[model samples]
Target: MTAHFVQVANAERLAADVMADVMTPPPPVDYLRWAEDNIIFTERESPLPGPYNRDLFFYFDEILRALSPDDPCRIVSVHKSAQLGGTVLANIFCGGSLAMDPGDFLYVHPTENNAQRWSKMKLVPMLKGTPALTKLFPMKARDGSDSVLYKERIDGKGAIQISGANSPASLSQVTMKRQVQDDLSKWEMNNAGDPETQADSRSQAHEFAKILKVSTPLVDPGCRITKSFEDGSQEKLYLPCPQCGHMQTLEWENFLANLDEDKPENSHFVCVDTECGGVIEEHHRPAMFKAAKLLELNGVEVWRSENPKAKRFHRSFHLWSAYSLLQSFERIARAWLNARGDPASEQTFFNDVVGRAYKTLGEAPPWEGLRDRAAKSDHPKGRIPVGFPIVTVGVDCQADRVEFQVVAWGRDYRRAVVDYGVFPGHISTKECWAFLDGLVRQEYANGYGRKIGMDLLAIDGNAWTEDVWGWAKRHLSSKVIMVRGVPSESAPLLARVKKERSRSGKLLSYSKRFYNFATSVLKMGLYRNLVKDDPLSRGHIALPRGLDDEYFRQLTAESRRAKRLKTGFIAYEWVKDPAQANEGLDTHLQAEAAAIKFGVRSMPDSMWDRYEADRERPPAEAQYEIEDLMAPGLPYVPPAPAAAPALPTKKLTKAKVRRGKWMNADG
Candidate 1:
């Protein structure tokens, strides 16, 4: 009951608590034999709750152990679905590494809020609830500090630093041997502008590059995380094939889309070489299946954990299923849109969830046999070859180059990029007009002696449009060339163009059928035909390349606006700035696209007569109706009154009275 006795009793309890927190010995197992055979972690965590499974656990554990001590960093990029225990596995690696080696380890999330949430929801609960795990170290509640340090466990200094992407300064201060990025894509830039460019460059530039990058795919191909995963220079996780026994790493190129209809999908693979036909099928290994199938790739150790039978142990681990479910459909749609700029998937995933509406890529443009046609002008013949109806000249212009497509239409269809000029350094408006005049002279030789129904000659209004417009007005007649207004905001128009791009890439332009020749060429993809071989189709199909960045932006915008109908045609709108949308080029390109839209591809100068004729004819649909009624009250008659009007007719009146014979009697 004395103070001294109370102190002694408190000391005894403290000693007992300390004694309980020690790492216990491993059960009788042949570590030596297991090492020799190299077969380890076999027991399903399902079969024995707490026992070590060498065949399963050792596969990943050995990898962690195999790294060089000085440069001990591994970046594992994982693409997974729900129910894979990759999170727990990641946590296990984090905890185990700190336990085995005394050093700092940081777990970086995309945001501070996420870091706090993970610590509260996963880390704190796991460490506190697991009695067996807690016994390995002294634990304490989190103070204001961002890290939870496990004091001096196994002569290895252990501490876990938790940080969000925003706290780069704090994250940089930590000198850690290992860093784990959990779902880096989710921590994107909330602000405007390019998210990829806004990401923390110092992380990779300093040390995080040497660590691990782990996440699901994102919507943007240009995303920082996606770019990092796609980078070929980095050492990716590769696994030895059970068949050929050769090692291979997973790549997006290896994935076969729509391979599975249910949970636990399989991947189909051939030899990495373009020529080899060797096949490899990747499925759930027994040990891997036993752990939890979060996601699997060749040789990547990305697996999650499952619920333990014991409540304490169950509560101690984070299930991958929970994390996977957190991935919203918005995220998936975003990823789909990112991987390919097609917005058809955006509508399906985000709006209706019906399905991807169009091809992953845009439609194959109508193959305009660039090579052979480039040699000499080729004109498809049917009608008059020389003098025909009015002629409409359709030209398409680009920034550095101007494509003068002279589409002469009648009974005959003649099209040619007659004058191709690649201008330098954004030429002046006078130069542009001069160039246009030159093209006309070179192609038509006296303008072909016909009136040209010119479409819009969109000049660079944003830059040097005034000069170009002035020159154009001075040189060309109002009847010969009319420039249309092109609005600066063309995002909506671009969206429409993107939506109708073919899924199978049929020889077509924006859901419109290409002429039969072009269609036939496209059907026989990437081939050298004996006759009328289409080089553009062949080259485009045979060697797919990323579109130009500016063009890609335009395509993406167009795709977003595209509306797919049950009628098998994609409806879209095209808006180009009349003054400056098509680089510094003239209105020819704009005119051509407009001509195509109007379904007037080729017509001679005489064809301009059609518009005049149309103007003279009465419009087909015009009529109106009116209410029928007579004037109110007796059909509306006016009463007249006598006055001075009789004075003027006095003589006539006297004559009329004499006829009655009364005048003779009065006389």
Candidate 2:
């Protein structure tokens, strides 16, 4: 009876101890402390294979502190250069969170293949090396809990989910408490929507959720990481000059100011402080970083721009290669020197080394400049310029009117705008169709006394597909074809013709063909050509006189811009304001497509010579009459009068004719 009483008392004591442990709160998770105490680097992952040392990259301390569970900052963004320990910081956060604050964690990459590669090459090595993480997530053979995409704790407290931003399925099915997005700027959209936003929504149920975003920026205005950095407290790391003791952010300009190309090793950073005017050498970086830490403790190393939208809970940091321990000033200077002449290489240097977005060449030229230049044009509207052999027309069908642009193509891809106008009537009406029919059949006289007929005509069928297709069927012999604009940036300038199918999924007997051209690609090429000032250069465009300012405004209305579609996909396309009209631009794209269809892009000099020879010959007897081309029940509308008098029909030598300029009367 005494033994049984002792057993009962012991059992009661055990139950009380269990209750006390359950009621006690777990200690706050200090991310930096946990990382330093637990994480171990492997030879495969790091150059220094040992216990994690914060002193090596002391600049990461503030960012690491922001990721702690006790910190109020829920979103921590880092815009950094390539080898600045950004990836290491992410891994540390993942390892620390899994070990100390057991909760569902997520790690996202740009693509599924990237995620798999990172899991095998990066995550596995860290897990195997770190003893504390191994205990939580043991990788046993045939273990159901441990897999390539997921790793769950043995205690059932939490798990780590690996996913790709391009795969919507993996990101949608699970809820995560802490998430890390690597290379956020490279994340592409999936069918489910923007992967970043979708991943963020998974953690909305947790009030104290933590999100860490890290990336090297891409193009300006379109870079996702840049946008996030701007939305947060734009904190820039400032290191003090050893000589002046004045703090300044490490800027590329300051580094370049004193760089010697022949001897890059002699390069030094110039202190921007007006009073000090000190020159700092590379050896002073270590001491400067240490000084910056002391200044940080005194609330001075990091500074934020005045942004009202920035919240205390969101902290962001920006760093470049100059701050990286692995990168030297000489190496960065050499990279800049190598990338001096090439735009592509320069862009890479800016994005990967400088940690800044590169401004692309797709920006629109100043409309005022183009307008002022057009006023000095020697050719007049309604007449083909001298030496141009091929003429094509582009039509834009709208609800109220149909806009058209006539372009003449010459050798070396030089082009001139002959005429542009609008037929003010509903596109579906026969009257509007009649006007277009007459224009297509009309002939324009050139300065060489040659009447040039259009080789091909392209009509935009994106709005009224059926009507445009019907009209195209009637003019099949005249090379009048229907076209649609493709939204993709990588699509070809002009795609192969696609046969139209009926709603019942049957191919039509007529074998009607339509073309789809990449609008983004064509517009990019057009903008690049528009900025060329030399008249003799290839792709130079000549604008005829009498073109109004409104025409130029319409031509320059749309600029390449980054926009988020309804599906949450961010794309760079030609976008214009609601108040601006871009019909002229659309017709110009269509005209270029029509020129491509006429084989002008690949046309040899012999073919151009034949066209030039044909212009000197008499008119063909098989030309279609204006009455035969007019729409039924519509009155005949005469073509506009010539802008200039016809030149004498004197035969001239090919050498005497200016390829893309006004000809002298002596010719």
Candidate 3:
């Protein structure tokens, strides 16, 4: 007892002093200064090795300062391309946390494989190179104590865990003071829930937790990083033009006029400032980077939300490849040269190189091009050309009448519009049914001088469901089918058919059943094909001369718009014009659906090669010859008059005539 303590009457004072010392909090640390002083960059892990140099990447200094424990923001958002050194910045924050503000921290990638690769190629090298970081984790690789997925702090009270957005279970357990998410665009979408919302839950337990998110922009309209960036004080890095001294965000658009696809090496970049008209040179970038400033909006800027009051507790930054020191203007021009003609490459250049979301067209291409491409052939508006081996028909069932388009298909997926016609009359009436019977039964001259009837027909059954069911039951055959459009953007262009019972409750027995498709997918394909089609390329659809501006406008009636989802990703949806009709779009999509039903897209390359070889030979010498088949003759069909008759819109005249433009003159 004497050795332990003297039992004095005033011993309470000593106990009170000890408690106060234990309760006092540690002093605030300067995160950016500490990173520069203590952090190490390995040759294997970083381009600039040894002590972390702040001057090399001045843009990241302010970012780290905001992430410091003393900063008011609990979340940090980073919207960037791969060239912006976002990956290195994330590693620096984690390293700083390990040294100064240690607590449970998390590093997440889009997938487990990505996380593991980053851990080994980046994290391990970083830790091994830095003395302070190395002391935090086990040194020996053989030490079964820690794996690539986890690094335990020597204190054991904290850890740095590596996880993937795809792994729900692994992401759930950790309660962290800091979390860093990289390549968020690549994260798998959770059907049952959102991976991001779930990941955000981990930091819920911490009072001053920090969240950092980074990624290159994807074309997706509802992309996660966009929302993350919007949640903060949206900041853009503004650098003065090397020549003009006029300040602006660097963009590829500034280089477009100087781009020479034919000679990318000689291509140049010019300043957009009209007053300066300066050509940007490779040597001018260093000074530009040095002078670059991360700018916040002044409340009235173009992106209005950049206003002060709009900002939340998070700080967001957008960095573009235009500011990348490693890339040269010539290199950027070269990349555009390789991407110019290809859709996929173009998207990549815009997303990865320029750092922007893929733009989906809300406005159709100028009509003048389509109108110019349309030249009158020997074939009339409704006549099939001799080259098309198969003719398919699609009917759009409107409330008053059925509008239809006929398409001609060849061996190479090359197509021509055989006809566009409007069949007027109530679809439920016998006269309308009679008109339909006449259209499907009519024959058109194939290029080989033989007559060919439609091999497949897909009627729009989405509307007038029961009426369509009755019609399908009457005309249900291998050649005649019904189709419905799916709303999902990701659904396949052509989905597997689901069998349905006839009006008599009889199940359709064949595997080739209803032709249901994703209209959205088909529209995207059509839009891309319209814009990217090179006359020399395959799978091009030619518009006939007789198609007026109204037809083309109707075909392009729907414009695509970017819609943000709750997940912070964007999806493109077709918005119909109040002034125009989508009858042209609907009919064309159905025809495309019919072609898919004919297994045109799925034909084996060998089969296609054989078909191509055979198409070159004379019809007589061809092994696979399309039969000059005509369906059984229908009752007397009348030629459609040039103008609409005086009949009421709702009235049907079956006895007077089965009137339709689709009827063949010879019939």
Best by lDDT: 2
- Higher TM-score: candidate 1 or 2? 2
Q: What are the runs in model 1 whose C-alpha is more than 4 Å off?
A: 1-63, 66-84, 129-138, 141-158, 190-210, 232-667
Candidate 1 overall lDDT versus native: 0.35
Instruction: Choose 1 or 3, whichever is better by lDDT.
Output: 3
Better of 2 and 3 by lDDT: 2
- lDDT per residue for candidate 3 within 1-667, as digits (tens), equals 3567655666788888888877978656676676777776666656666776765676687677778777778788888766778887887788878777678889989878889999888888778767778888764545544788988777675678999888887787678889998887667555535678778889999888888888887655655687678777887766677776776666567677777778766665677787887877667777876655323223222222354543457888877766676677778888776565444445567777877766545466666676667664445566555446667888888766787888887644567787776666667989888877877787765444345577788888777766765676676577777888875543456765665556797775432456679776567557666654454455566666766565677677787786666866455567887755677789998998998888776566676666445442234522431232333564332222122111112212222122322332223
Please, what are the lDDT tens digits per residue for candidate 1 over residues 1-667? 6555333458877888777755454233322222323212223323334433444443334333323243223344433332243455555556555544436666777778777888776776555544433655445434433244223343244567777766545455445566667765455433332222223332344442325555543333222344443441222334434344344443333433423323222334454644444554444233233333222423434422222222211111111111222233234334443323113223223211211111222222223332333334232211112322323443333343333333333222222222222332134445555666654443221122222333333222223434444444554332223223332111111111222333586532312211111111111111212122332321111111211222212211211134444433233323333321222123333433334333443334455566435332222342212221343454422211111111000111223222421122123
In order of appearance, the predictions have TM-scores of 0.34, 0.60, 0.58
Per model, how many backbone clashes are there? 51, 0, 10
Off by over 4 Å in 3: 1-28, 34-51, 139-145, 260-274, 291-305, 310-312, 362-526, 531-667
Worst 10 residues of 2 by lDDT: 649-658
Give the per-residue lDDT of model 2 (tens digit) for 583-607. 7789998998889888877788899
Best model number under TM-score: 2
